[model samples]
Target: HAVVDTTGAGDLYAAGVLFGLSRGAAPDHAARLGSIAAAEVISHLGARPRMDLVAVAKSILG
Candidate 1:
């Protein structure tokens, strides 16, 4: 795993998990959301990008 930065990935993943829980998603689903969000950050060369995660989740869950 190439680490360019460890600034906000953890925070963003937490946020994603929280968001999923707030939306009434199951724990497993929330964890998956967090994992996906974290993966997005790690796959790139920066922290979580300035994107709308709610929109992404809506699209994904739809």
Candidate 2:
């Protein structure tokens, strides 16, 4: 995603990382999750998730 702005990137990334860790993912895997979440956040204007993150994470992890 382009970095037009980096408003909530870190928070989203942290959310993803924590979500992954809660699911028992490895640290590396968790980082990947954070990347995914941050990507979602930075893709648009706000920090809001366009899609359901839990479902998205489940789909990706599964």
Candidate 3:
């Protein structure tokens, strides 16, 4: 994704990593989730998600 902003990228990454860990994902997988979340946040103008993260995760994991 094209980067528009960097605000809250770290926080979103942490959130994604924690979420993945809570769901029993492997370390690399968790980090992948974190990367995905950070990518999403940086692609837009704000820290808030513009799309459904659940859907994004499902699509990626599946």
Best by TM-score: 3
Residue-wise C-alpha lDDT for candidate 2, range 1-62, written one tens digit per residue = 47655689999999999999999888998899899888887888887878788887787778
Q: Between candidates 2 and 3, which one is better according to TM-score?
A: 3
> Which has the better TM-score: candidate 1, or candidate 3?
3
lDDT of 3 by residue, 1-62 (tens): 57899998999899888888888888888889889888889998988978787777666566
RMSD of each: 2.4, 1.3, 1.4
The regions of model 3 sitting more than 4 angstroms off are: 60-62
Measured with C-alpha atoms, the lDDT of residue 31 in candidate 3 is 87
**CA shift of 13, model 2, Å:** 0.3
TM-score of each: 0.72, 0.84, 0.86
Tell me the TM-score of model 1: 0.72
Mark the 10 consecutive residues where model 2 has the least summed lDDT. Answer: 1-10
Candidate 2 positional error at 43, Å: 1.1
Identify the runs in model 2 with alpha carbons over 4 angstroms from their true place. none
lDDT of 1 at 56: 82
